[model samples]
Target: MLSIAMSTLRERWVAFVVSLVALALGVGIIATIALVMNSALTGFPGQRAALTGTVVLLSVSAGVTGFATVFIVASTFALTVIQRTRELALFRLIGATPQQVRRMIVIEALLLAAIGCVAGVVISLVGAPVLASVLASSGLAPSWFEVSISPVPLVLVCLGGMGLTALSVSVASRRAATIRPTQSLRESAGDPPGARPGRSARTGWGVALLLISLMGMGVVAAVLPELATVPVVYLWVLLTLVAAVALLAPALVLPVLRLLTLPWARGGSAIGTLVRENTLTMARRTAATTLPILITAGMSISLLGALETIGHAQSVEAGERLRADYVLVPEGGPAISAEALDRARKIPGVRIAPLAPTTVQVTGEAGLADGFWGYATDAQRFAAMTSLPLIDGTLEDFGPGGIVVSDIWELGAGQRVTVTPDGGKPVQLTVAAVVGDSAGGGDFYLDVSDTGPRPAEAAYVQAGGEAAAALRERSGELGASLLTKAEWAATVGNSDQGTGVIGMLVTLGIAIVYSCIAIVNTMVMAATARRRDLTLLRLLGATSRQAVAALLAESVVIAAAAMVLATAASAINFAGLLAALTQVVPGATLAVPWAPVLAFAATSALLAILATTLTATAAVRTPAPLSE
Candidate 1:
């Protein structure tokens, strides 16, 4: 059987080449992502350490990329195996047992996996430096950081690749095992295996997983709010939702395609009707192509949605926290001095409030890092110049013995908390008020008198007329620079936006590239599969233009099916995330980044159509008799 498999492979190597390349590239990408993620986990820069959420984002990226790779590779193997139906059927007709046939297919697949895995590992090693450079340039990693080739990740990823290939081929081999000898020779043999099992079983599993995730989240939010914010927990829910979409997509594809073609089906040109009919008939082919697009769009949109929502929320929080017309921050490294504050206040028409920002460790029950960002400012001036909406008590109640806390602290008015500052003894202070949360934990506000006169990190100034001009001019003397409210808001918002955009672009780039490859591979093989049918149509009076139209229509249907599935998946993911976030974060809101979503849809559709049309062009050119 092994020798027979080798002989079969030698004869059909051309058909197998695409599968090999797809497997290699897919595994290469997965390995590269694993390497990058490992480096990030081990070598995170110390200078900017603040639990900045970059790690979680990178981990999400790695997971999404890995999932895409596995799906693409699986689809490739299924397509490859199906293309060999005639050969498998021939073996069966020659009195080969089903067990021998299965073994033959598995041996060929294992051979391909061995070759592909080596190529993929090599590609990963060669690509590591480029990956590291991109990360460094994007400011994701420090300049001093370099890619370290870890043997453990490489070996593990290779093993994963082999395992994934084995699973894919095993499933695909079922078709070989079940097909009758005569049917294989007569049928087109393009449809993938495993289309008829308990689709209900898959659907049931999907729904069960989604329900469990939602219920689990609700229970966690109600009982243990602390664990609700863990990134891995959210990641697990996200993975479950994506898995549900994958399981549900095949069931949904046909109905959605039918609905979309209704207009053409009703009263359309002959060519359009013919095109629509062909697309509807070959639902499996359309689905095979659509699956990649679905994965790409769903993952990109969901991840981008979460990032944009968080960024927007942060921006809104920053804008609402202060009512100052202008803010001054030190240009160099030094903090704003008392003299600078006095001088700014002495300026005409200026109402200046200086703030001293620091981080502290809570020494009592409330001494948690969640609400440790502390700031000291003049009580009356702070209240007058900022829009810190109080949840209880009044900002005017803040004094030398009192402090203000954000809602994150969960402490009520008149509650006492102890804090230990850098190089200082523990101090006990009464909570004068609790305010709504802000971007940077605007928690733990203390009277400057109580904390002693510390250097000011920033000052909020309300100045108009010539006072603004005077403050701007004296900014150099005050060792600070002045920015208007809009500039200040932008300054506060831009960093998060930059990070989110970079992450989105990186994810989008990877998805688009892999999806295009999958689209091209699927369409070409599908076009090849239908060559006889298309050639027969040409023989039976169908014009070349009409044949091309049919192919384009099929492509559009596939793309449309993908778009629908992707949107459904993204919506489910976003809803779950928003619900979970609202439970943990006080003011979380649903904000869809529609532009990227639309862009993904358009690009996916365009790529699918163009790839199918290009491949079909060649089919239309082939002489009818030669097509067989």
Candidate 2:
């Protein structure tokens, strides 16, 4: 079996090369993520500091990459098997058992996986520093971070890659086993197996899986609301929907193509009609081409939409939470001093609200939580300059020795809590006010005087008519930059924007790369496979230009079908994400980044055109026809 598999791979190395490269790259990405996670765990202390949201992001990305790798590897290998239909049929005629044939294919996959996994590990070794640098630059990792190389993650990833590759070949192996002994005498290869047993089974599975996932989510929302905060929920739902579409893709392609080709069939040029018919006849080819597109576009749009929506929500909340006309703060410098606060307040008709910011370790009824962003401010002045939407108690009680908590806290006003400021003695304080979660900052607020002589990190000033202009001029003299409410909101938005963009790029970048490789390989092979037909068309009076145009049109039609299907799958993914976010983090609105989505679609189309056109043009440049 090993010898036979090696011989077969030697014979078909051209077709196997792309599958090998793609699998290696995909596996490399997954291994890199694992290494990064391991490094963070060993280097960073505490669960929150090490990985929380970042872990979720990396896991989702790895899941998408793994899914795509399976799809592309399986499709490419299946295509290779189809090309050897007659050869396999001859082996069957020679009395090779179906089991032997299946073993042969599986062995081939294992061997390929071994090679790919080794290559992937080597690539990951080179890529680790680059990955760490990127994470550091994006503020996702600390400056002291360095990649930790360990054999554990590499071995695990290698085994995982091998397992995925073997599983992916099941469909291809089954197809090979089912080849009849008589097929060796046929002129061309028969159709590869359908995506599933039948249309009804495929449709049934798609609906059943979708419903089951939705039901599971509904249960999570109702019974365990906190579980909705887990990113796995989003990843599972997205991959489940993607799998259903993959099952249904082959069955649905022809009908969709027919429906879309009606206008072209009626009045378009002969080349257009020919292109449409050619794509329709090749269902497996079309499915292989479209699957990667669906995954790439679906993942890209869904993730970008989710991140942008969350960022927009945060920005909006920040803007609405501010009540002061202008906020003054040093730009990454030392805190503002009492002299600066005095100078600002000396301006005519101005009332200054000073806030000393510090993080504290809280020991309360809910247990110990550290690094809570707490600010100390004068209650009366704070109340005069800003509004706190209270869930309980009033700002009038927010004086010396008093504290305010956000709605997320279990402790309310009148509860005794121990707050330990960094380098300070733990003090017992009474919570005077419990504000709504949208209060937009640290949960704990203490009296300014009790927070000691720590300089003020921020201050909000309310100025009347003439005092507003006077305040703006003396802002620099007070050693702080003055920003209007809108400007302050913009500053906050910019910070979130950096994080969001980084996340978006890392998640979507892998998918797009896979999509490009799949498109180019499928288009080149498709064109090459139909070379005889193209030559015959030219012999029958069709011009080379027309032939190329037909191929171009065919590429467009396949890309269009892929985009439509991908959009549908993405809608499902986005809906699932929105549902989870609503339960976990309330008040987040759905924000679709139309520009990025459109750009992704346009790039897919352009790649398809360029790939198909170049391949078709080269294939049709033959000097003369040869007898098959």
Candidate 3:
């Protein structure tokens, strides 16, 4: 079996090379993430809060990379098995048992996986430091952070990669092993089977997963609205939908292709007819090619769209809540000075609410100390400057020793909570009011007197008549920047979402690269298998140019179908996210990432066309004897 597997790999190395590269890249990404995460956990002693964000980022990266790896590996393995149907049939004809065939397939996959894993580990040794530097520069990690290589993480990732490969190949092997010797040979001659028994199971699982995702969306919208903006939650839902679509691709791709090609088919174009017929007859291959596009384009659009929408909603909400005429920010320092605040206050008919940022350590029910960021301000002036929605109690009650908390806290009106300031003794303060969550709003608010003497971070001002111009002039003299409410909102919208968007892009980077590799791999493999069909076309008097044109057209149809299906899936995902956002930010609107999604689709389609055209053109140029 080992010798046979080695011989087969050498004979079909072109077909296997893509899988090997993809697996190696996947394993490398996973290993790198593991190393970074492990270092974050062990190296950042006594700085759990600082390292928590890094750990979360690494974990999300691992999840995204793992899913893409498994998905691409499985699809490629399945395609490989399909392409080798005739070869497998010959083995059965030569007295090879089904078990033996299955074992051979598994052995082949293990061999490929072993080499891929080793190469991946070596790549990680060079990549880990670079990745660590990136994270540190991005402020996701500490400036002193360094990658700590351990043998344990490397070994575990290699084993996990092999295990995943075996599992993926085993499923594909089962179908290959069941191929009857005579039937496979006949099918190889162009009379493919209509439908497999597994189609029903795939459809069933697809429907079940979609239903589960819908329920999850509902739970988040109705019960845990706070999670609506969480990237991981959105990712979980997006992945479920992507999987459901992938499972149902075989059943769904044909209809979409037919619909897309209907005008061309009816127009009596030969290339169109061929494209339609080919996709219909080769539904599995079309589905396999489409899966990568769906995963990449769909996931990218949905996740990025959700983030954009959330940011837009927060900005709009913040703008609507602010009753300020101008926002005063420090020009060259972190906080506004007291003299600057006095100068602004001296302006005629100007009301200023200064906010001083602070943090408090809360002792949770588990006796664990947790940090909650808040601001110190005069509640009366703050309420006058911003219309903060109150869930309970009143801002009028927020005075000396009283604390205003965001709805995230469990405390309600009149509840006493212990909070220790950064450099002060722990003290009990009454919860005066609970406000709804808003972008840029801290977790809680304290009376100016309770928070000691701290410079104001920013101030919201209400100026009427000539007071606005007077305040603006004074602000410049005080070395402060004055921004209108709209400008402030735009700045908030752009700045607050930067880290989230960067993190999301980092996570999707792996998926996008894997998807590109998978798309090209699947297309080349499909084109190689169609050499016989291309030859038959040449025998039937079709020119090489014509045959290659037909193949390219078919690739275009497949790419278009994948994009259309991805757009639909992303729309569903956006709807669920928007539904959840409505509870948190009223009148929230969708913000589709048109540029990135369209660009991704175009790139993938171009890759498919190139891969098919080049491979099929070469196949058409080769003259071969007609099969008996």
Candidate 4:
């Protein structure tokens, strides 16, 4: 059996080679992500603790990193498996038995997995100590992190990754199996769509998926009560992605190609014809590449929307509850000081109302609010000036030591919640009515008296945007911040630290891999199809540059149209995530990060052009097609 398997693989080495390479890249990606995140987070707690000895930051950072990584891994794996269809099909055609083919694929994946795992461990081992040393040198703490490698988790990670690879390879193998053995004599290998599966099965999958989406959304609406809108919305949008990718790919390409003709179709007849002609010919491969992009765009956009909504909501909650023109503070960043407030109240356009601010650590599993101390005063008239709505418990609940909170905190209502106070125990506080004050963006609020006589100073201030600006200008040397509602909106909305840079990095990282591989494959396939055509084009007076342009123009059309689909998917996804956020985060509102989306889309398009520019070499200058 072993001899037969090796002999079969030798004959069908192309598919086997392709499968191994694809699987290696995917498994390597998964293992690397795990390795990177673990290495990054492993030292995070120790570093932060060394600096401040505050354990809370450790939890918060760890939570955020972990949550984002989970989603990133999912997106990466899904993209990886989808790109290996042709290679998988080729394996079945090479006289390898189905079981043997499967084993070969699995073994290839395992080899890659083992290699990736070892590489990752090596990275952590070598890199962690260096990072710790740097932190110590920088005066951060008890002088660096201990070198520790928890073998158990790494082993588990390897096992889990291998399992995913096996499963994905198995599922994708169906495409290969559909190719009739007799067809191997006539065709090179099963292409992107491969052998068409039975219609009934496709229909069954589409219908079942649609139904599941509808049912899931309906169930979410029924079970989550106040949060019903959110989950339902998410379910609906996710279904939209599934349905579009599954049902639309094969049939929709040519139609979209014709549509691309509308631009140059008016006058540049040659360009228009080239664009349409190219797309019509290469839709399947283009569509396959475009599908993953659409999903990522949708997911990223949707999640971004959720985050924006939550931020705005929190702001409104904070603004509505605090009505001060200025948060008079001394020289420090978070806590308020008496000397600072006295000077601030003397400033122009400054009406200091019952000034109050307290340093209290919000303890929640989700870290719903920003990492900081909660501040409160006897309601801001400026907040009223900004039109922050009081949807729940009144601002009247706010007084010295009597605090008000947004309605999202109802979880701890009427119960003693432990909080780290500036100069006291983890005091327990009674629940106050949760309210929406998105205009101010406050995560938590506290009464002045709750401050417990540590100091007589201003922690918060309320002022109009103009007034805030004037104050900053006149006393820019005061070394403090004074922000109006509009400024705050733009500021909080734009803060980079929320989703953090690492999230985008991971997304782009996987996307780059997908784009590179897919482009290479497309070029390879296109070259094969257009061998004679290209030779003819070269003979017909087209320069190498012109040929490159034509190829890129084709790529641009495909990428741009696909990006639009991705954008639309993202929009819907964002709306769904917002609905979920509405229930989970107080004052959560939908936010669309258009700038990032556009930037990303533009980059992908450019990359596509570059891809064609580099790979078009085969068609640009070669007159004779290479004979296999």
The positional error of residue 227 in candidate 3, measured at the CA in angstroms, is 1.8
In model 3, the Cα lDDT at residue 379 comes to 71
Give Cα-based local distance difference scores for all models: 0.69, 0.72, 0.81, 0.47
What is the C-alpha lDDT profile of model 2 across 1-628, one tens digit per residue? 9999999889878767767877788788889887877676665675444355466556656777787777777777777677667788889999999999989989988888899999999988987778878876766665566788988989999999999998888887877888878878776433533433225444576668767766765765565544433334445655677667766777766777887787888987687678676666666667767766666666666666655664555566667667888778764444788777877777778887777877788775568575687787766778766666688988888878888887666777898888887668888888888975441466677876666756787788787768878877877777788778888766653343122456646766766776667767766766666677778778889899887887788888888888878777778766666565565446656788899888988887788789888878888997335443
Among all windows of 10 consecutive residues in model 1, the one with the lowest summed lDDT is 225-234
Q: Mind giving the per-residue lDDT tens digits that candidate 4 earns over 323-423?
A: 44445333333334544555656776666543343566666868653344455443433233323344555544444434556655554434446566665
Better of 2 and 3 by TM-score: 3
Q: Count the clashes in each prediction.
A: 1, 0, 0, 44
TM-score per model over all chains:
0.77, 0.80, 0.89, 0.65
- Give lDDT tens digits, candidate 3, residues 256-307: 9879999987999887888888777767667777777777777777777877
Could you list the CA RMSD of all candidates, in the order they appear? Answer: 5.2, 4.9, 3.4, 7.5
> Candidate 2, clashing residue pairs?
none
Kindly provide the TM-score of model 1 when superposed on the true structure, using C-alpha atoms. 0.77
Residues forming the 10-long window of minimal summed lDDT in candidate 2: 492-501
Best-performing candidate as measured by lDDT: 3
Error of 4 at 289 (Å): 3.0
Shift of residue 315 alpha carbon in model 1, Å: 3.4
